[model samples]
Target chain A: MIKLAVPRGSIQKNVSEILADLSIDIPDYNRANRVYSYEFKNINDAIARSFAEKDIPIQVALGNYDLGIVTSWWADELLIKYPHLSIENLILFNDSVSKLYSTRSNDKLPLNDNLDEHIIVTEFPNITTDYLYANRTTNYRVFEAWGNPETWLNGDASIAILPEEKLTDNVKVIDSIYQGGLLLIGNKKNLKKIKESKLFKLLNEYKGLSSRSPFHFFDNKINDYVNNTKKIYSTRKQIRIAIPDGHAFRHTALALNNAGVEIKGYTDSEVIQGDLSNNVNMIINVMRPQDMPQAVSLGLYDIAITGRDWLKNFIYNYPTAPVFEMHDLKQSKYRIGAVVSKDLNVTNVNEAMEVWASQGIKKIRIASEYFGIADYFARNFIKSEYQIIPISGASEGFVPEDAEILVEGTETGATLEANNLEMKDLILESTNCIIGHKNLIDNVNPLIVDFINRFQ
Target chain B: MVDTLKKFQVIEQLFRDVLNANNFTEIRTNTVQPLNLYTSAGTLTPSMLHGTYSFLDWDGWSGERVVLRPDVTVPAAQWYLNNMEGQEAKLFYIEPVYRFIDDKNNREIWQCGTELIGISPETANEAIIKLVTELLGKLNLTTAIKVIITNKDNNLQVDNYDSLPDESIAKRLIKALGNIFDKHGFNYEFIDASQNKKFEYYTNYAFSVIANDTEILSGGRYDNLCEGLGGKKAYASGFAFNMNELIKLLSDEQ
Candidate 1:
C-alpha cells in the first residue's frame, strides 16, 4: 500500500488542483474544517494525508508516508540539517516559486562587527544556521519564530531570513539562499519499489513542468507596510523588554496598565516599540512570545513577557541557559499535556503506549510545537521508541492521523474536544510570565523593577 | 555468536597484553559526557562536532546537553584535568565511541586506545609509534606506518628533514621517529602532512597504520587539547586501533 502526504493551508488550493489533474481525488481537502486523512478513490490500495507544508519533508523522511508533496525550500531545510534522510524522486513544480532572502537591518550594519553581534530571527532556523555555519560565522544565537519575520526586521532582529514579500524598506537584502517551489518527494526505499506503479508513473510524467508560468512571490510584491516609523534613539545603557504581540497582547497590555507601567502608544488595540517611559534607559519591543526565551538568554533583551510554556521549552532544550522567570503575570493560563484521540480509549500516556504496542507500532510519532517538552514526555512516560515531529502550529489535527499523540498547550479543553482529542497527561500548568537573565536580574534598571512590582 | 565473541575477546586480550606490558594503565571514562567539553574552541573540528550524538539529560531543565562519548581523546584530557593534572601518565582504554557518520543514527565504534600525557613532544611521539607497531606485530599483522609531518611554513618539504631549517616540533618528531623505527626494525614512512591533510587539532604530527589501504589505527600529538579542556599546557599524544578493522584483518588471515 502506498501512503502519500500532502500540504495544508495557503498552498492547499493549488495542491488540490494538481491532485485533480492527476485524477487523485481526496475528499474535504480544501475545506476549513477538514480531517487530515483521506482515501484515493481512483487509485487502489492507496491513501493520502494532509499536513502543514513545513512538516511534509519530515513525514516523508521518517518513512511514515511512502510519498510526500512539499516545498523545495522545506525539503532543502530538512536535508541541510539532516543530510542522511532518504528522500528521493524530487519533482519540482515550476509554477510555484519563492526565494529565501538573508536580510540585514539598514540601521545597524556595523561593518567591522562579527555576525554573532547581530540578532537574526527566522521561521527557517535550520536554514539560517546552515548558512551561518557554511560562512564560518560561529558563536551565534539564532532564535526561531512562528511567523511575521518582517515584524522583527525593525529593532529586535538585526538580521533575518524571509521571503521578498515580507521585506521592508528599513532592511537590506544580503543574499538569496534557496529559490524554492512546490515539489514531490518520496522515501528512497519505497520510491524504488513503486517506480512501476501508477502513482510513480503519473508523478514522473509531470517532472518537465518548465513550460508552466512560474508563480513568483516577487512579481506582486507587497509595499513596505511593516516599517518601524517610530525609532528609539540608540543608547548604550538602554534596557530592552520584549512583549508578546499575538494572543497574549491584550492580557499583557492590561497587566501593564494595571501596574501603571504605561507606554504612550501601547494599548489593547495597538502595541508599541520604543521607550515605554520618557526615561532614556527604558526601551520596549514587540515580538513573538516563542522567541523571547532565547532572546533573553542571549542578552539581546533585558527581560521579556512570555508564556511559561515557552520558558519551559527553552529551559528544557538548553538546561544551562541563564534565563529564569522573574515574575508570573498570572494571566493567559493553560495546561500543556499529551493529547490523544478519545476513540483510542487511552486516558493516559501508559494506556496509549499499550494500545500502540498492541497495534504492532514500533516507533510512536508525537507531534508538538514544543519538541523539547514532547521529547521529555515521551522519554518519561512512553517507555518505547518514539519520534517527536516538530511542527509549526495546528497541532490539534495531528492525533489519530499524522501523529499518535500531541504534546500541546490548551487554555481550555474545548479545542481538543472539538478535534476529538483529549488530554491524556498534563505535563505543565502554565501562565503568562516575565523572564530575565540570571546574571542581570539583580542589576535590572529601576523602571523595569517598577514594571514587575505592578504585576504583584 | 560464540565464535564472534571469541574473536572479539582474542583481539581485546591482545591489545591489553601489549598496552599492559608497556606500563600503560587502563582507565575507563564515562559513556556520557557534557556537550560543552567537546565544543570549546580548538577542541574538535567543525565536522567532528557536527557528528556528535547529543541530547538533553533527564534533569536537562537547566539547558545542558550530554553526548554519548564521541571521541575518547578529548575526554582523556578531561579525565586528566579532573583527576591527575600536572602528572605523567600512560592511560589506555577499550571503549566504544559514538558518532553519526553521514547519518542521523548513532554509529558506535569500539576503539582500543592509549594516551601518553605530560611527556616531551619527541619522546611521546616516538613512544606511541613504537607501541602501535609492537601491538600490530604481536597480533600477527605486519603493518606499514605513515608518519605525517606538518610544518608551520607550508613551503618546506625535506627528504632528510633535519636540514630543513628551524628546530620545529615537526622536524624533531620526524628525526626521533626515524631513529626509533630504525632501531626497532619497524616498517615506517614519513609523509607530507598536506597530501592527506586530516589534521584535526593535531599540532605537530599524525600517523596512520594502513594494511591493504584500510586504516587499522591512527593518532597524533595534540598539545593544545589539555589547555582547551581547562588545564595547563601539557604535551599529549594518543592512538586508537579500530578494533573492528583489526578483527576483520585477523579473521581474513585465519
Candidate 2:
C-alpha cells in the first residue's frame, strides 16, 4: 500500500479537491481541525497531514511516507538537508503561486530593469545568495523580513524579493522571474513503482492547480537567531566516506574508518544518516573498468579505488575526468596476464605464439577482463584468428573448463594456484589506488586530508 | 540470361514510360547535408541523428562536423526553397540513404520519393495520391493495395508536441501507425501524414500504402513547410517509395 503525506492547511484543501475530481474518496478528513488523517477505501493507501511542508520531506526520506506533495521551495530545502534522498518523479506543474522579487523603490537601485545593483531582502539566505552569485550579480544584499512582501514593500528598504503572485495593490512587478513549482517527493523504495503507476498520471494532472508563487511571509527573527549561532560552529569536520557494499569495500571502509575517519557503506542505514558535516569522502571498488565512467558521471562518489591497468585500457574511447591518486593501498595485487592449462607445452609468450602458428590454429578464443591486452597480443602474435570474451567474475575458472585460455587480473595467484593453471605472460602489474576528483584535490576536505595523512 | 536482361530492360522502360505519361520527372541530389538542416526541420532527434553516418572532417580545419545524410526530405525541401524562389516546383529523387544501425551495420537504403512545393493542398494531394495509385498499378501484384488516410494535425496531436520533449509528434505518429500496421498483419507500415506529420504548417492530408502488412508508398501535404524554412508559407505535398524494401518483398514472393 502506498502511504502519502500531505502538507496541512491550504494545500490540504487543494489535495482533497484534486482527489475528489479523480473519484478517489477520502474518509475522516475533519473540516475544523488542522490535524487530519484520511484513508482511501478502494485503494490500499493512507494520507498523513502535517502542518510543516518541510517536515513532509523528512518523513518521506525516513521511509515513513511512500509519497508526498510538497512545494518546490520545501523540496529544495529538504534536498539541502538530506542530499542522499533520491528525488524521482520531479514533474514541473504549470500552476505557480508566486516568486520572490525586489519591490523596494530606489531611483539609483537597479530594481527590475537592472537587478545587478539591487539589495534584496529575504529569509532564504542560502538559496537567494547562491542564485545571485551564480547569476554574477554581486551588489545584492539580503535583509530579514517579518511577514509578507506587502509589509516589506511598504518599508524604506530599496529592494525586497517576494512572491510574484502575492504582489499587493501598493506594489507592481517590474520583472518577473520564474521560481520552480510544486514537487512530488517519493521514497527510494517506492520511486520506481510510483513512476510506473497510474498515480503518477493523476498527480501530473493536478500539478497546475497546486502551482502558485511560493510566498516567504514567515517571521525571519527566529531564522536570524539560528543563523547567528550556526556561523560560530561552521568548521569543517572529518570526511564522511561512503563505500559500496561488499566484502572488499567493507574491508576498505573498515581500514579507513579504523584510521580515525568517517566511512560509510552505500546502503539504506548510512544514506539515511546523511551527515556530510565531517569532510566526506566516497570510495568505489571497481571490479570492472567499464563501470568507472558511469560512476564518475553519477557524482555519487568523490573518489574511486581502482586499478591503473583498468583505467588505461577501458577508458580509451571516452574522455575520463581528471583523478588524483591518494595512496596505493596494494590490498589485492593483480597482474593483467595470460593463463593456460598446466599440461600445455608452451612455457613462454614467444613459445606460445610459435606453437599456435605452426599448428595452423588460425582462430583462437581468449577470455579476459583485459580485452585491450588480448587485442594487442592478437595483432602482433603471428596473425592468428582470435576472439576475446570478457568475463566479469571468476575469470580464472574459465580456463580449460569454460574456455581454452584466459586473460585475467589476479593477485597472489591463489585462485590460479587452486585452478591448477599457470600464468603464460604478465602484461602489467596493478595495485589498489586511492583516487580523488582533480577539482577537489586542492580543496581536499580536512577530514579526508587527515585520513590520507594516516595512510602516509 | 540475355533474354532476362532484355525483359528487365523492357520493365524499366515501361516504368519510365508511365512516369513520363504522368508528367513526372526523375530527379536526384547529393546524399550529404548540414546537421542543422534536420534540426531546423523539427524532425531531427537524438535517435535519428545518431543513426546518420557522421565523421569529423578536420584534416586541415580546426573544427569538425558530421558528414552523411540520413533523410532525403530535408535536403529536398531546402532545394525547392532555394531554386524555385517564388514559383512552384515538382521534383523527385531516387537515391541510397546512409544510416547507422546496430552491430556495425550501415543501412544503405534506396528511396524513390517526390516533393511538390508551393502548390495548393487540394491540388497537390490529389496529384500525389493519383500518382502513387498509377505507380502501384504498374507493379501487377496479386496482393491487395490499401491506402490509410490520416490528417497531419488531428492524427499527429500537435498540441502535445512541446510536452513530448524528445521526437516530434509527427515522428511518434508514424511510429504509432507502424505499431497499428504491425498488429493488423501489414508486413510494411505506411505513415500517413495526417496521422504523423507534426510540422504546424501541414494543414492537409497525408497517406501511406500497405500490401500484406508492408508499407510500399508514403506521401503527405506540408502546407507550412516553406514558412518553417523562413520562406513565405506555401502549400506543399509529396510521396516516396522504399525501392529496396519493395524489391526485397517482390523477390521473396518468387
Best by the lDDT measure: 1
Worst 10 residues of 2 chain B by lDDT: B56-65
DockQ for all models? 0.12, 0.02
Tens-place lDDT per residue, model 2, A318-390, is 2344444566777667787777877666786567657666866555667665655666655565245676654
Query: Model 2, residue B28: displacement in angstroms?
Result: 12
TM-score of each: 0.74, 0.41
The numbered model that scores best in TM-score is 1
Clashes of each: 8, 33
* Cα lDDT of model 1 by residue, A300-414, tens digit: 6779999999999878777777789999877888999999999998668788788888999888989998987988788788887888899878775677767898999998899
Per-residue alpha-carbon lDDT of model 2 for B1-254, expressed as tens digits? 55444433443455567667766666666766755455445454444554566542322011113447776776777777787757877777767778765433328766777788877655665566456645654553444445565654555433334443244424444455445444445454233333443223345555666766766666777766666666776767787776644653342222
Model 2 regions more than 4 Å off = A1-244, A254-260, A264-277, A280-290, A297-302, A317-331, A348-362, A369-385, A436-456, B1-108, B112-206, B209-216, B221-238, B245-254
Q: How accurate is candidate 1 locally (lDDT)?
A: 0.72
* Cα misplacement distance, residue A218 of candidate 1 (Å): 21
